[model samples]
Target: MNRPVRTGTDPDEARARILEVAEQHFRRIGYHKTPVADIASELGMSPANVYRFFPSRDAINESICGRVLNEVAEIALAIACTNAPAVEKLDQLLTALHQHNKMTLVKEKHMHDLIAAATQENWSIIKAHTERTVTIFEAIIRAGIEAGEFEVEDAAEAARAVRSAFMQFFHPVLIEHCVQHSEDIEADLRDQIRFILKALRKRGSLEHHRQDQDSQPIHG
Candidate 1:
């Protein structure tokens, strides 16, 4: 006789299994359509049992979304940990992030939809991811400043500005809009990066220009 399957009594294992099944369902049939019952059924458990692990479907979505964001964060962390100069690291990091996101949209349409929805809803996971990414940017900026590549007074503020300026390339909704409109996203991203680099370098020049003006005798 075949042995009966068990859902297992370990809470952590149960939660992990739930997330794995839910992610599979989300990728296959889309998260919006994959009810909690379906996930429980797939695990040979009752919906109420699934609820014991995750309070609600949204909570499950948040966990899955967090997992996806963690992948992107890992990419950023890898680029940051490289020995390249700060300027080059920042450029490569931004390009890699953009390419990864665009690839996801093209190759993982269902997963992309889930992320887009999470972004639109302003999920806490999204905010946490953004903060983590900004922290990475801030570290890069600080390194660049130390290396005399960037001349910003506040690395944190500059990092936030960089994130804001690059939102078009990073934000899922904006990226999708660009694709739908057939915009030259690659060209635009390059232009934007160049513009940001220029801004970082120009701050020092502007400061010197003001000092030069201050040193000159004022005409009475």
Candidate 2:
């Protein structure tokens, strides 16, 4: 008699399941304290089996961190696609990104710590995420240039500069430090954005200047 074959879980599904369970544990227990064994046990699998999907705990953390970064990227893309003027879009995008990072630090400290460590370690995922964010900035800058809103000669270079200048607001580690030190982050963020906009605006663009002056201050 022929015997029925036992089917194993799909590799991709298993990997995703492992990430889900690991993230839950990272949230409940701290990221540094959550062991692969705990994740495996919760998933009803052996630690070795989990290892088959992710070579090490750090590898799993990298995947989870990537997902978190991707959410920020999505928010940027959504703002970029809006019909609003490029200048306004850039303002909103930067503010939204900063607020998202701050929210993560307040609500998900463990996940924030994981990403901060990844940033300090110069992880590949961090590099990739930075590139993605810079690309979004470049696109917005290009649109602004086309609309005579910005006088920058090179969108790509300007985008990189913007990213560097806003590091304190965007970087997880720096954001946390600002929060801990009670350094009036919102005021600083607004000042930084205004400075960047001034640098990007065309000479004597009174209309944009007036619009910026009239616009309500960004909150959060």
Candidate 3:
């Protein structure tokens, strides 16, 4: 049964309501199966009224996907702003990103389908998400440079490199592939993070990392 129209709302609130209901229907029934008319009916409004807020169903899908992708972006931004060391912050950021993708794609295949469709459709969401991620990576790299932890002539370029190097670990489709292939994902992910940190560190910092590794006795 549809809920009563949320009374006394402005345009922004109405749009939000449509999105909220639309997301529910999409999550429950699949994005392609859900119609704007169904979303409108849920909100006790007509499809025409819904179109007044969003131009079309594709617009709504894009908005929903963007909102979902922004969760990772928000987490990365928060980590970038933290008082942690750049290396540690980067590690945490990467781990969080991987886990978030796994949780969404591997564990929650429904959401994965939504994201995959958005990506295949070439929505602006992917470009916007990539820009946000690169910005966060650049912030961390700049911090490492300031802290004398990293040696890089250009933070933006280094950030791009880092993103490229870790793409396999963070990309949703790639992560799904690893799962399906039964790859040694944990060991590979650790190796990737180790390599990224080693590449980003100054000569002295790299030496220190090597020494730290050597100092730890091997465990059988």
Candidate 4:
């Protein structure tokens, strides 16, 4: 005879299953409206049993949102590898930023309401992920400058520029503006990508380098 499934399955397995179910629930119904019982029913467990595995609903929500954000950042960093052209990487970064933030809203709306909680309790995860993205782009910028394809000064600052541009693109207030005006953010982003890259490149620095090289005495 087939047996009934049990609660508190391996902790890791149970958490993963909970997150998978929560993603759908949060997407279908906003976070506040998605009760622990709803997720438990979907997973074929009693509400108390689910709680044994996850102490609180907000905790479960944070785990699922963190997982999705990491996946999106990994994909963006992979496509931003040095083998890709700067322009190509820029476009990938912009696309990833837009899609990631959009999905982040849908998946973790509760986290927004609980921002103070997360900032106090979970800020390290946030800082670590942001640092990871900055480091990845810094590597790409340094590589491009060495290759002579890009004339960039201060890879650190350049990385920050890319990060800041994306920040603006994904800013919540600006997102509301975009929704209200129905502006084509994608089209605007493409235009802004060029401006971002141009600003990052060492404009006058490159010209000065060229002048110095031309002035060098020939050693025949």
- Tell me, by TM-score, which candidate is best: 2
TM-score: the better of candidates 2 and 3: 2
Ranking 3 against 4 by lDDT, winner: 3
Candidate with the larger TM-score of 2 and 4:
2
lDDT of 1 by residue, 1-220 (tens): 2211254557787788889888999988999899988888888878888888888878999999998899999999999999987877887788888888888898898888889999999999999999999999999999999988789899999999999999888799898887778567776777687777767764555355335434544221
TM-scores, one per candidate = 0.87, 0.92, 0.89, 0.71
- The order by descending TM-score is 2, 3, 1, 4
**Clash-forming residue pairs, model 2:** none
**Candidate numbers sorted by lDDT from highest down:** 2, 1, 3, 4
Number of the top-ranking candidate, with lDDT as the measure: 2
1-220 in candidate 2: lDDT tens per residue?
2211111747888888888888888877778899888787777777887888888878998999988898999999999999998888998899999999999999988889888999999999999999999999999999999999999999999999999989989899889888888568788888888888888888788466647645776566
Q: How accurate locally, in lDDT, is each candidate? A: 0.83, 0.86, 0.81, 0.64
TM-score of 1: 0.87
Worst 10 residues of 3 by lDDT: 211-220
- Superposed model 1: Cα runs more than 4 Å off: 1-8, 202-220
Residue 77 local lDDT, model 4:
71
For candidate 3, write residues 30-126 as lDDT tens digits.
Answer: 8888988898888887888788888888899999998789888899988888998888789778877887887787566767788877766777998
For candidate 3, what is the TM-score?
Answer: 0.89
Clashing residue pairs found in predicted model 4:
none
Cα lDDT for residue 188, model 4? Answer: 62
Task: List residue ranges in candidate 2 displaced over 4 A.
Answer: 1-7, 206-215
